[model samples]
Target chain A: MSIAFFAAFFLAWQYSIVWFDIPRYILTPPSVIVTKGWADIDRLLYYTWITGVEVVLGYAVAVILALPLGLAIAFSSILRRTIYPFVVCVEMVPKIAFAPLFISWLGFGLLPKVIIVFLVCFFPIVLNAILAFSSLSEELSRFSVSTGASVWRTFVKVRLPAALPQCFVGFKYAAINATVGAAIAEFIGSDQGLGFYIQIVTGNMRPDLAFAGIFFLTILGLALFGLVTLAERLLIPWHISVRHQSR
Target chain B: MNPLIELTGVQKVFGAGPGALHAFGPVDMKIEKGEFVSLLGPSGCGKSTLMLMIAGLLDATGGRIAIDGRTVVGPQTDIGIMFQDNTLVPWRTVRGNIELQLELRGLSTAAHRASVDELLASVHLEDFQRRYPHELSGGMQQRAAFCQALVHQPATMLLDEPLGKLDAMTREAIRTDLQALWIQRHPTVVFVTHSIEEAIQLSTHVAIITPRPGRVERIISVDLPYPRDFEVKSSPQFIGYVRQAQEIFRGYGVL
Candidate 1:
């Protein structure tokens, strides 16, 4: 069904410019975009690689940092009271505003883009993880205690696995945000990456090239999102959402 | 011998200051070792409150509760408990959930593999051992939960309406399974329920509680014989205990 939808949508996109007598420069056909992308495969590959790095690294750093922080905040009143407010305060500020500051401070390199991506991905991961960690069934809590489970044991054996399904909510959000974040960072200031390539192509009035950059960016975004979903399926196949997916 | 569980004027208040809510109260009871005691009352009459206090999961606002002559200072680790909701971890299969108890207690789940499978078999959940909790029927889930509670063989079992969520047929089936498990190994049980028949069918003694700001109105012994399954539930003696409970509940303005 998804394939059919894509095929129909792309077919319309491939022919609509000709049907409407639209100029080639204004709106490129899907075929033109694909042809141009394939002709400039090396350049597209290079820029896509750059963007992919920022997407993966930035998101990875956020996951590594935010997940533990979230779980910590949930587990400790001290962290919840002290750290969580600061997190909320940070979240309140528009994440895009950080792109300029990051680029200026860190310079126009991969570091700035990565930081922006990390910042974009951080809040949801942390907040959702906190919710996931804390949202336990009273029954499971009682059962864990009844088994004489220590705090650490309970967290590892009971709390962690139970929290994964919900934790994936944050992870998925972070994954989608990662691509946009990298794009924003690159947009604000960068000489390389697909985001920068699109800027260059659009400036040159080569909409086909710009469209190809977007196509690659979309693939990158979907791939990262799919990675998270795949992990969710693997880690928590018992979750109702995942269970329902198979059926 | 002293009772396995003792409550001396135990009461629970939810909060303090002007907002203090008297949940349940100043009721005392003693439960001997291996005795199946049910704290039976109408809904919202603090039946589960009593169970939590005994489990040491919830603190009493006043007085004291002790088990084996020691005051319950914190959540007791040496017991099994079941709630109305089947507490099976969604990520685990039936077998894994049962093994979780031993795993949490720093025991080897692999060593107890046979026992875990045996627990599944006892509940007739062996066929679905590999299935997740969400995949099972409500009765099957509760049965698995019952095994999860019983796996470690705790000396005292605090079961708060384990069969409450199931339909009548499923409840009856699991009730018998519970009896069979208990009969196999007579752990001291403190069951909380609103069902008088459920109380009488399983309990050796029933402690009737009055409505809100609940206190134990009286404690009556149900002298029915072993394996109080469906047949015993309909037995004249079982009906007699039911009437006795109803008689006490009647005085408290309950049907």
Candidate 2:
């Protein structure tokens, strides 16, 4: 049903562009964009793969770094107090402002793009991790303690599992932000990636090609988001959110 | 023999200085071995707090608690607790939840498989052993929690209204199940509940507590026989005990 609605909407969009006599440079019809996308399929796929790698790698790195950082902050009030303000300070600065600095530091290569993605994806993972760990029910904690579970055992068996549903929430947000970060980095400085392709096509007054690049980028973002959702379902099948989703 | 559990001058204060709220206090009690004692009181009467202290999950601001002649400096392995919420780890199946108790005691699954099976059978949850907590109803989850709490056969059990969330019918059924289990195992139990009939039905002695800064207002002894069923609740003897407990609660303006 949803697919049918989307198809009808796209057909209407195509007809509306022609009916309104809009120029291709300003607004490309869906049919024209599809044809242009087919013509540039090789280059588009290549760039899409590059962007995909950067987004996935950056997201993986962010998950690795943010989970433990969040756990550390959640476990200790002193550490939370000491480090939270610094995190907020860094997050307060628009991450895009760091694009030139990253390009300068790492040279306009994959490293800079990856770092941009990492920076964009980091905050949500950490915030959600902190929220998940800290917000654990007191009853659960008490039950764990009553079981005479060691601090380490309690963390591994109870705390970690309890925090997982919320952490997946962070993972979903980070996955989407990762794509944005990669695109933004490519926008500022990159020779490859869909973002650079979009820049080239638009500069050459080919809105159809630019829109094709955008179409692939949207697909990439959705694919990444879908993968995270799948992983969440696989890993935490017992979570209430996941169970409800099945229904 | 010494009391299985003892609390002397035990008190809990939430904060310090003038703004401090005295939650429960100066409460003294001795629970004998193989006894089912219910701490009954109104909500916010610190019944849960008192249970926490006994379970060694919370420290009393003043006084001390000892179990089996040992001062409770920390959580002891011999004590088991079931909270108001079932607290079943969402990720674990019913069998997995029951096995957690054995695991914590360093017992291998192979060694305790029979016990786990028996517990599930006793609760009539053998069919649902592979189901996760989310798949179970509230009563089933509570039963799984009860199995988890007792799987290792801890010497003492601290239950904080473990069936408070169940519907009336389910509550009564589980109450009977719990009584049968207690009869079989005879562990020293400190059951906290707000329901007067629940306390009377399960406990050998009902320790009626006052409101906040809770103290044992009185201890009402129920001389009912063991292996009690639902029929016992309708008996004249049961009515007499319930009326006596109600009268005491009314006297303290807690009813």
Candidate 3:
């Protein structure tokens, strides 16, 4: 169903561009984008790999840092009261405002792009992790204690697994934000990556190549999202949301 | 021998000062070892509050609750609890949930495998042991919960409406299973329920309680034989006991 819709939309796009006599430099047709993509497959793949690496690495770093920080905050009222407001304050600032600062400190290389991605993706992971841990059912906690489970046992056996489904919600959001962060960082200043490639091609009046880079970015975002979903299925098959989905 | 569970002047108040709400009790009760006692009351009667105190999940504003001669300062290893909700961890299989008791007690998987299997067999859920809680029917989930409570072999079980959420047929089936299980294990059980019939059907004694600022209105001995089956529900003696309980509730303005 979705495939047919996209196919028809592409045909309309192709015909409308020709019928309106739109200049190729402004809005390239689907055929032109595809031809450009095919002709520059090697270059596209190379730059796509760079952006993909930045996104995955930044997302991985964000999850690693956010989970423990979230747990610490959730477990302790002192930390939650002190750190949570500061986190919200920092999150409220426009993340793009940090791009120039990051580039200046880390230079116009992959480091700045990855850091920007990490900054963009960090808040959701932390917030979701905190919410997941804190929102565990009181009944489960009571049952755990009544069964004589130690604090550590309750955390590992009950709390951690219970938090997984909500944590995956953050992961999905972070996956998409990861690509956008990488792209925004590259747009500001970078030497290599899909975003850099698009900037170069568009400046040189090659919308076809620019559109090709965009197509690859969309695929990258989707693939990363798919990976997060796959991990969720593997880790929490017993979750109500996931269980019903299978049926 | 001392009573398995003893409560003297137990009470709970939700807050302090002028706004304080007296939730339940200035009540005393006792159950001998291996007895089935039902706490019968109306909605909002604080029956569950009393159970929580006995399980050491909540503190009484005043008075004492002791199990096996030890005061319940906090949740103890020797007591098992099941609430109205199944409380099954969603990410675990039926077998996995049952094994949680053993795991929490520091028993390794290899050591507890046989016991877990036996628990599943007893509940007739051996075939569905690998299924997750959401995949099972309500009765099955309750059965799995019962196994989770029993697997650790606690000497006393505190159940707060454990089977209250099931359909009538499912409830009857699980009640039968519970009776059979109880006969075999003989754990001292304090079951909280609003159903007078349920209280009489299972318990050796029924502790009838009044609403908010709940007190033990009366205690009635069931005097029914063990291994009770569905036929007991239709028996004239059972009807007499139900009538006696209803009259008490009527006097208390609860019926």
lDDT of each residue in B1-255, candidate 3, tens digit only:
899889999999999999999999999999999999999999899999999888888999999998889888877667788987878887788988888877877777788789888888888999999998888999999999999988878888999999888888988888888888899889999999988988999999999999888999889999888777767888999999999989988997888
Give stretches of model 3 more than 4 Å off: A244-247
The residue-by-residue lDDT of candidate 2 on A185-237, one tens digit each, is: 99889999999999999999999999899999999999999999999999898
Model 2 DockQ reads 0.70
Query: DockQ, per-model, please?
Result: 0.81, 0.70, 0.73
In model 1, what is chain B's TM-score?
0.97
In model 1, which regions exceed 4 Å deviation?
A: B229-231
Docking class of 2: medium
Poorly placed runs, candidate 2 (over 4 Å): none
For A142-172, candidate 1 gives per-residue lDDT tens digits of: 8788777788999889889889988999999
Worst 10 residues of 2 chain A by lDDT: A141-150
**If candidate 1 were superposed on the true structure by all CA atoms, what would the RMSD be?**
1.6
